[model samples]
Target: MYVAVKGGEKAIDAAHAWLAEERRGPEDVAELSVDQIKGQLKLAVNRVMAEGSLYDPDLAALAIKQARGDLIEAIFLIRAYRTTLPRFGGSEPVDTEAMACDRRVSATFKDAPGGQVLGPTFDYTHRLLDFKLAADGEVPSAPERAEAPETKPHIMSFLDREDLIQPEPEGAETPPDLTREPLELPAARPLRLQSLTRGDEGFILGMAYSTQRGYARNHAFVAELRIGACAVEMGIPELGFAIELGEVELTECETVNQFQGSKTEPPQFTRGYGLVFGMCERKAISMALVDRALRWKELGEDNVGAPAQDEEFVLYHADNIQATGFLEHIKLPHYVDFQSELELIRKLRREAMGQVRQEAAE
Candidate 1:
């Protein structure tokens, strides 16, 4: 039956037209350029890129524009586009040691190699509104200075020499790609990290916060947090050598954690690692904390029934796309189900009234 309920096509078309007008705002106002969003609102672009698992700044900017500056929507656009791309070949892992770092800091040591460079951070900035920016929006260029040489050794190398930290086994085993396969519980570290890097920033932040609130608390110290660009390389089987593809901005974090030794082993400091697509230090740090918390079983610690410690729970709910799809589905038509429920409720009420009247007559 052709019912009036199916007449939403015209309404949807009109709604889309209205949305387009609202997105552009008034014609009198200056139209926002994608370059402006990419350059000025760089952090938002970085977040979309990081979560989308793509590295193209231009495309990310375009996605942002199309999404009306909604970060999640932009991420969704990028991710959806990414699925249509043909997989050529995987690149060799980039070396962070050779990274040209812009921002590098460590909390574990007072003085470290490469001398803690604090480049372009809002850590100490006052949160007060800048009236001048609102009025003119003009920003002066920073004073020119000679670029320092990049020679920072990892903080963990010092502890490694002293045999104070747990040593990871060196191997060339290829890790599982979460994107290609169905997620199964008791996930490996690589799968867990994959989920976390592409996870919703707010969700990962909350999970990390839970650890700080004593949910499987692992005393974590930021051993090193670095933001910079590293050259990506890909091996050519024909040439029998690896060639540089390009450089990509990355935020890498290494967290030193307290590990209580089991009956078979000695106590030593553990480690948690986080590496993201772009300059997202907050997400990187949060991923590290959550990563360490989920390492309970491998580290020989009790489960403690913490949310972050549950691999199944963390991996399943970490994806924003999946979460949003399920959540938004509630708005879809449920007329048949609601009607059935209404009829059942009325019938129950009538039956209760009849029972009461019979008891009164008795």
Candidate 2:
């Protein structure tokens, strides 16, 4: 006997309660503070901020805790909170050239204007887990260096001196916001770069890897990568000037890609760029490569129909929040739709059986 079950509301309430309990495990034990999460789980917080398009570490940490350690859920939470926030005004384009960088390096050059500083990185470290960190051990700090100039230089400027790199055009026009509007086909460079900045780390990495594996193999050299904090300024109409709103950490990567000299154009190198929130160098670098690959059409390069070269494919699927939402949404109730499909299949089977019997009698 088939019986209809109806407890959707109660089930939802119970699930929510369980989730809350899981998020704040063992009530007797001390709860995790936002500061502790921000400091201890820094990489996860960085990923959330980068994907969420917000710079607040504390908020990101809180979201992480609330989401029960799901990074994408944390990003979704931050994104939802971001929408309710009242935007006072737009900020002036940050001057990366004037950025006081903590770490800056270039793969294209051995030495540049701002000397290479390989700050804290996991590149050289062995993959083995550190046992000392299990007890929350303290390590000795490195010796401090002399204070550098307030306005540090960019490595790309050195290449521009000899006209080696293409000069970026200066524009005073404001760019469009992707979050406010539905993404359209044939997006501009600004929009594409914006989407890539907050894109899923693994998705971007896979796309970048595809290009390297001959999907659209454009030889790429890391022109420069910089990680540091920069002041954000907002224009105040009352004051008639921009004021420093706050400071945020950023990771920026610029890649010099191979360019085949066309009949009309000279053999000059092109570029791919990535800029993301916080100190996420690997993600930024991967994003830059994919960005360049997607720009093949504008650069007059032949499109090999690579996944990386497809603008619609890359931009639409890059966002982790959107991807995860759609993926997980399949778990939601679809009983009505499933029932309709089942009825149709049963009707088709009955018709087939009747036809077979009639044919056998004939």
Candidate 3:
């Protein structure tokens, strides 16, 4: 019942040629440059870098160009490329306290140490289309500010000192790497956070929104959301000291959520943390909310069967590449299976018709 399709190789080559031509579009239009994409389509590059778990902007921009403006495909390309690279050593955990922040804001406090610098945000921008931009698009430069402070204490430290928030215990045990190892059920906080950080932005956003709509609602207040550059350090075994490994732009979000008190414990605020590779505030915030919601088991909260609270559901379905590959695989040849199904249906129909004919004769 299975028939083999011929000329697949020639068909594929012809299709690829057509695709190359399509990617370039009309010959009159200027082809997109990687640098132009990197500078102008920054948010696309940022999303790719953040989700791909790689911070090379140039490469991300190249992937964007090759993927034809599909950010998820760009992320997939980056991720695939990342797997082939050699691993040196792991960098030290970044010190966000000493981050040279470009943008720092606190919704919990009226006055923060950095004084709420709203640097380069589209939050207040109107949605109106500017026709002038189509003719000659040039963004005006922003007014310069004084040099940022070298160090600023975290807003959570104040609550930490008062024991008002659940204490995060530091452990010497190395956390499990989800990228290296297969994911297991009842994931630890580190694994959960890793999964959430690399998860699809829209899927995580939808899950976070579900939490807000009373599916395991955790009243979350954005304690601090900071976007800035932080120095990464790596210990050199030969040098016997840690050395700086350049800086990376990060968007760190800390959400303070409602608490529950048990017989032995007093009511204290809980924390949801999110740290991403680029200046992606919305993704970071959504990751934080979903992170908090998924901590239901450890926090001694009831399982309200929320999508955000389901670790197996969230972690498995959150990888866009995996989801896309499986979804798109349907377009591939299914003739054999379809033929088998058709044969089965026909046989069943034949049997049913034969029975009807016999009954009529009787």
Candidate 4:
């Protein structure tokens, strides 16, 4: 049975009122709208959606506003709101191969089949701050572009024809849901991928960086990175076919690692994969590296006892919501435990003082 901490009604009400007042900020300034957040603060909305495991941009933006721009707290609000949502039938795997390319590039190929198309990126921009934005935030119109090719073939397919990269046969008709299932050790690739895609970005990025810093022997080559809109199809049993639900923006990364051949297999390059909602290239790349690091056993490699290689550790600590609850609980009322500790410490001190006085008197 859960114990409700009863009391402090007035104080709680006062705190809430003050919090609302603070959230509103100065009366002179205009309030931010959800549409503005969804349109301008696209990355922030993407991060909340990715971590919250909800793809709705408008809801994510509303959560951000409600949380006063605290992303983790925004994610918490989104998660709480998610519980009320009804489950629609799951969609078939989205066809990334036929994605309408917004930004597609490959490090493995200098002049690949579909040449690099640099769409809105910060990669080449000088880091200097534009002080003009302090007063006015106006920008000129972007250059128009002709529509890209109807189909941009995956770069990895070229290597696959030559048998250079390891093959990944599709298994598991339906992937398991981490939200529904209790996380068990020795998780399969599908489950691991599920957790990684929704996992905390900072944690995943740090873990991936650790591998790059010699914590693990997993170094990745960017075989291909693509960002685009793909149609989502949901199976309609009544209609006897799947129908397109809508389009969702996705970022996918495929990385090739060093070749390692076991006794049964010949020397071939291994691969890592990352796919997430929106143009989250950094998180996608991080997830791919970490994914590769965790696949040591399956790839017939010995474990070096790295944190990233430990599925149990990574999976348990990856969810920021779970981590925050565990951590934040300590700050709540722990009066009973704190009082017990205080009494014990005082008793020990009294005994020591008494012994010292007795010894001196004798």
lDDT of 3 by residue, 1-362 (tens): 66877768988999999988988889999999999998998888889999998989999999999888888889999999999999877887889988888888889997877678787898789978889999998778878856844456799998999999988868545678888899998888898888889999999999999999999899899999999999999989999999997899999999999887655457999999989988899999999999999988877888888888999999999989889989999998998998899999999999999999999999
Model 2 residue 193 lDDT? 86
Clashing pairs in 4: none
User: Would you list the C-alpha lDDT of every candidate in the order shown?
Assistant: 0.89, 0.86, 0.89, 0.90
Q: Clash pairs of candidate 1? A: none
Between prediction 2 and prediction 3, the one with superior TM-score is 3
For candidate 4, lDDT tens digit of each residue in 189-303?
9999999999999999999999999988777899999998999999998999889999999999999999668766689999999999988999999999999999888888878
Which structure is stronger by lDDT: 1 or 2? 1
Which wins on TM-score, candidate 2 or candidate 4?
A: 4
Looking at candidate 4, the ten consecutive residues that score lowest on lDDT are: 144-153
In terms of lDDT, model 1 sits at 0.89
Q: Rank the candidates by lDDT, best first.
A: 4, 1, 3, 2
Residue-pair clashes per candidate = 0, 0, 0, 0
lDDT of 2: 0.86
Among all windows of 10 consecutive residues in model 1, the one with the lowest summed lDDT is 1-10
Give the clashing pairs for model 3: none
lDDT of 3 at 12: 92
Cand. 2 TM to true fold? 0.94
Could you give candidate 1's per-residue lDDT for residues 318-347 as a string of tens digits? 889888889988898877777888999999
> Candidate 2, residues 1-362: lDDT per residue as tens digits?
23466877987999999988888899998999999999988889999999999889999999999988988889999999999999776888887775668788889888576678787777789989999988777999887888656444666677678776656655446887898888898998888988999999999999999998899998889989988888888788999888988888888999988787655455677788888888888899999899889977767788888899999999999999899889998897777778888999999999999999999999
